[model samples]
Target: MAISDVDLASLLCSKICHDLLSPVGAINNGLELLEGETDPVMRDRCMDLLADSARASADKLKYFRLAFGAAGGFGEEVDPAEARQLIETLIDDSGKITLGWALQNEALPKKAIKILLNLTLIAKEALVRGGSLDVGAEKGDLGIEVVVRAEGAKIALDDAIRSALDGTIASADLSARTAAAWMTRELAVENGGDLRISSPSATELLLGAIVTA
Candidate 1:
């Protein structure tokens, strides 16, 4: 049986929600604990945990909403500063990855921004062993080009993810890789563009998108 693209997209969204529920729920639980605890010291500590978890969960939600959901509301273009801030927050909250940006454009098409964010998430997942990620964009005579590269000690590019990027896997069964790939493809198509993916070695993965100027 085959899955419709809509269903696949829904499944991807579901997976994202599933992954996030834990930490978000923990934040709620911590808040409840803080409410019941009478000790000022213990209450203070619980409050700290609640605050940190809330911020982290919120940051992830913001990034994921833009990356996996709609592309509008920031207008037809996205401010590079906002994008940079969101990326920074995502890395900081995760606490296991580093992100470096070399953005040449001050603003990007909203669809392009979505693609970039999704690709960044995919690169972060690939760098499970702690590594550095480089994300940059350049403008050419043809259009805008965005590039994401991940390098680490042990990079594992999931086959399902590759399949999604290659348009061989249905979106419904999208794991991390597949969701990113699917989002990338959708953004490319929306912008009259295309995506290119390359994994030259076990520790390196590259993803790029080219869209009209």
Candidate 2:
């Protein structure tokens, strides 16, 4: 089933909001506590919480801006370094997920960058027990190849998310949890490419995408 443009936009927006709610809420709560707190140590704790929440919110926004927004600027290609920084900060927030980036290209088309970021997000989700995520991209005659590998004590990818990434899910079944996967597949397909997911072991997940140049 084809999702209407309006519906797709709405779902994507919902996903973004859902991902940001926790940190934003924490920031608000920190502010509220700071306003009423009288003790110096508690006040400092509130400040720390606020700072951490603010940083998290900012990092998520930056990642989403490039992954799902037009903040790619006026360029047809984006610097891979920028995408790296966004993903690094995002994974760093988990404090359990480590990132290994290896991009052979200095710059990649915006579509490819979006696909890379979204795929990274999906792979990170599969790392249920915290893990190492490796992301790599390269341009070739066939097109641009993007790969993400996640390995941890426990890794799991939902069937719905896999269907969404493979473009087999019905529009009515789409949810915030799978929106990024859906969008990642759409981006690849729109550019004459597709995404792949592989699980060679219960503790490892691999995601790959190839977008035509």
Candidate 3:
């Protein structure tokens, strides 16, 4: 099945909106509660909730802007530190998944950065029961290589996501949930590379990608 540019764009937009809805909705709810409560103590609590929700929403937007939207200006290379910080904040908000980072690049091509972020996102999602996520990337003469490993008491990766990342899923079967995986795979292919997925055990999942500049 073939996906047009418009379809891809719509799917990505839906994915972003779906992921952001929770925190954004919390912000709205906090506002409503704060407006009705007159008690000082309860008001303070509502304010705290609003603050946290706003922060969460902001963090997710930053991550998605780089991972899915155009960020880091029009420069060919993007600073790896920016990507790292976004990933750190995203995982920190979860308070469930621990992140281990080992990016060996001062800067990477924009496409490589997006792929790295998306692959890491997918790996992080595999930790259904809260676990460890390790992300690594390196640039070599051939291209950039990224590896993301997730290990936990229970790792659950939807088969559809696996198919999307491996370029086996038909476009007609794609959904917002799998949009990131599909975009990551397409970006890798566009950059003269491919993605790989492996499940060494039920408790572990590994995702790898190699994309050339």
Candidate 4:
């Protein structure tokens, strides 16, 4: 169930815009408030709000550029440190979620980098109640293995996303919410890789992908 390239591009753009709407809207609102505020203390508070909103907007753009666009410099491989920084920024405003990154100094191929970033995005969304996300990768005899684990008080995975990642959902049914998951699966398959999801426990969700070099 593959979609036309145009359709895929449109879907991704919609996803990014939707994710950014909140913080961007806040920035606009903050500007309006600042324009009307007269008290010194109130004006300072509005400025703080604007700063936070601007940071969040920038973070979202950085995360999306890696996950949905090309941003890792022109190369066959992307630096793992850059990926870590992108993920950290992505979760900065998503409550008290801690990240555990453990990847070798070696770089990952462009395809693997995309898969990793998309999986990281999905895992971050699953931890609505705020939790720990551990991302690790290693190149082995089998292939490049990427694992993203999420554990929190409430780990809720939407059924649509689960099916999409498992390659059971139809392309026509894919919405912006499940678009990234579908894209992740597609990338894995194109690279002789596979995506898997462990039967999440009461409070844990595991996403794994393997790409053969």
Write the number of the candidate with greater TM-score, choosing between 2 and 3: 3
Where in model 3 is the C-alpha error above 4 Å?
Answer: none
Q: What pairs collide in candidate 3?
A: none
C-alpha local distance difference test of each model:
0.79, 0.88, 0.88, 0.89
| Each model's backbone clash number | 1, 0, 0, 0
lDDT for each residue of candidate 1 in 1-213, tens digit (9 for 90 to 100) = 244678768867776887688778889899889878999999989988888888878888888888877746754788877888888887776577888889965788877788888888888878888788899987787688989999989888877887777667753556643665776776686677888889557888898888887
For candidate 1, the lDDT comes to 0.79
Error of model 4, residue 168, in angstroms:
0.4
Candidate 1, residue 19: lDDT? 67
Give one digit per residue, the lDDT tens place, for model 4 in 1-213: 868778878889999999999999999999999999999999999999999999999988988888878774654788899899889888887658999988998988878888999998888888989999999999988899999999999988888999989999975579888888999998899889899998957699999999996
TM-score of decoy 3: 0.95
User: Which residue pairs of candidate 1 clash?
Assistant: 8-172
Residue lDDT tens for model 2, 66-166: 88888947448998989998988988887999989898648789999999899898889889889899999998788999999999998888888888987
lDDT for model 3, on a 0 to 1 scale?
Answer: 0.88
TM-scores of all predicted structures: 0.87, 0.95, 0.95, 0.96
Can you rank all candidates by TM-score, best first? 4, 3, 2, 1
